[model samples]
Target chain A: MNYPNKKKSFQKEVNKANLGMTLESDIDATNRYYLDSGIAVIHKKPTPIQVVNVSYPARNKAKITEAYYKTPSTTDYNGVFKGKYIDFDAKETNSTTSFPLKNIHPHQISHLTSVEKQNGIAFFIIHFKPYNEYYILPIHLLMPLWENQYKEKGRKSIPYAYFKDNLHQIHFSYQPRLDYLKVIQTVFNF
Target chain B: MNYPNKKKSFQKEVNKANLGMTLESDIDATNRYYLDSGIAVIHKKPTPIQVVNVSYPARNKAKITEAYYKTPSTTDYNGVFKGKYIDFDAKETNSTTSFPLKNIHPHQISHLTSVEKQNGIAFFIIHFKPYNEYYILPIHLLMPLWENQYKEKGRKSIPYAYFKDNLHQIHFSYQPRLDYLKVIQTVFNF
Candidate 1:
């Protein structure tokens, strides 16, 4: 397999986080496990990039040299899970008290809202740094916090305690580092 | 909006063809239109990159000096379309007679196959250069061609006549340049 150099760096960065494991690497391992075991078909969506310069070393092969990241218009991970379309973003924050609302964008919130309107499962797996605790917070709950963050000054985060109380906590295991589907089963009643 | 610089030259080369417009530009315009009109929620996925060199010209944001394009593990564009999960890739060819199979990777073909198995709509929009004709070829049709390409002397192309006869043709309009949803409705009964 021709793994991209960026993926290797991403993996290295994940290793540095060392919160049991990074959110991205965990997602990758979990997806591989699920695909192998025939549990669900889920994958991390690639980041959109605009390539400006490339060096053609060979006739058909071109190596991109200059590119800039484009703001994605949708969620990071999405696929069919148990007959329902699943869409979500996985984020990690080091804040001990609260998770910042800045991690998400207005377009993402809008996208999740539409997903909910369409009856698809839309949520996020938020990892609290240092503690290594992961919570699956539904879009319904996140929208209010996101809006309130802007409405109220100096309030742009969700308390870790709030997540512990309201959201379903996903227990990380060796097999599936995030193991969010277990929480999904209970939350969506699927 | 921070547009990526990496695709500048590529887009320029595409525009130089002078057929009508570029696939990338058309996609961007279509997505913007969709967002503005409140149609289906969709976006092109990003390519994750690792910034190897950076020059901090400003205090807040650092400019990337050197970077490499990452090979995406999944498809390019995906989102909720009329309550169904839609996943696909858009590819263009300068060849008037055939579309090269080499443009697609084995992993992508495998991913699309799995998407189809899960009952999600998976397909590709083939843009025929010079003629400016576009066709949406289902994953089922593409898999065979992909396999045949590998087996038969590594034949790396599918003729335009084959696409004309087998695939659903998509008409481009000013509003939605590659307005594929119309073809999607006719093809998938969605």
Candidate 2:
């Protein structure tokens, strides 16, 4: 199994507040577990990068010297589970009251909507950092709130109370770390 | 849509032989056409990269100073098609007589296998550069030959004759340069 170098990148900087086990890491571990256990074939897409320059320091060793992160057009994670396509993104917010809508790119929402239209399960896995809580909100549930935000009286963010009321909270586990698939099974029933 | 900068990278060096219109670029245009026409929502994944260092030259601008390309675990392209998961890789070979088996990575084969297990439509879009011909070979058709490569008496590569006989050649069009999905619909009968 030829893989890339083990060196970490600035991508992990966002999780510095979590000590070590951030929601992203937990989800990564869970996805790995899922892959190993034959439960599902999920994976986080590699971070999109726009390379400006590269140097060939040695033969077969191309090093990118200048690059910039690109906004991904699709969700961070996607895969097939029991003949169903699963697509989602994970976000963590420090606010205890609400999750700011700006965290999600408009492209992601449109991509998820397209996925849902094609009969795939699309969703967001949100982590309320202050409360140490995780919630899987399907795109179907999120659409109305998302549409409402553009209206005159709509809120720009989704309140934590709304998540607590409408979504099933995912709890931590040993093997998979975050048993999101379990929550998904109950929510999606497939 | 705020996209990344318009800087070309070493990634394009591989297609220098084509002068300009490589299979990749054609597929990119085709995918864009599919997106605009509201056809199947498929996309080629960004090149996987492993960043080692990043420097912030300005307040909000991050410049990646050191990075390396990673071997992709899955195929280059995947998305929802006709409410089904679609997965595939596009490869261009200069050879006219045969398509080298080594052109495919083991991880890609494994990933496609898993996709097929989950009932996703997994395939390979091969462009024989010398002949200006394209062929979409399903994962199932490729698997037996892949296994045979390990056997003592088996051939190392698949001859062009095999592809011509077994698969339908994808012709070029103006809107979607490579009409692969049409070939797929005809082949898979979906």
The candidate scoring highest on DockQ is 2
Candidate 2 chain B weakest lDDT stretch, 10 residues: B3-12
lDDT of 2 by residue, A118-143 (tens): 78889999989888889999999988
The positional error of residue A171 in candidate 2, measured at the CA in angstroms, is 2.2
The two-chain DockQ for each candidate, comma-separated, is 0.32, 0.59
- First chain TM-score, candidate 1: 0.85
Off by over 4 Å in 1: A1-21, A46-73, A94-97, A150-156, B1-21, B152-156
| lDDT score of residue A59 within candidate 1 | 43
List runs of model 2 lying over 4 Å from the truth. A1-21, B1-21
Residue B53 error for model 2, in Å?
A: 1.3
Per-prediction TM-score: 0.79, 0.89
TM-score of chain B taken alone, every candidate: 0.82, 0.89
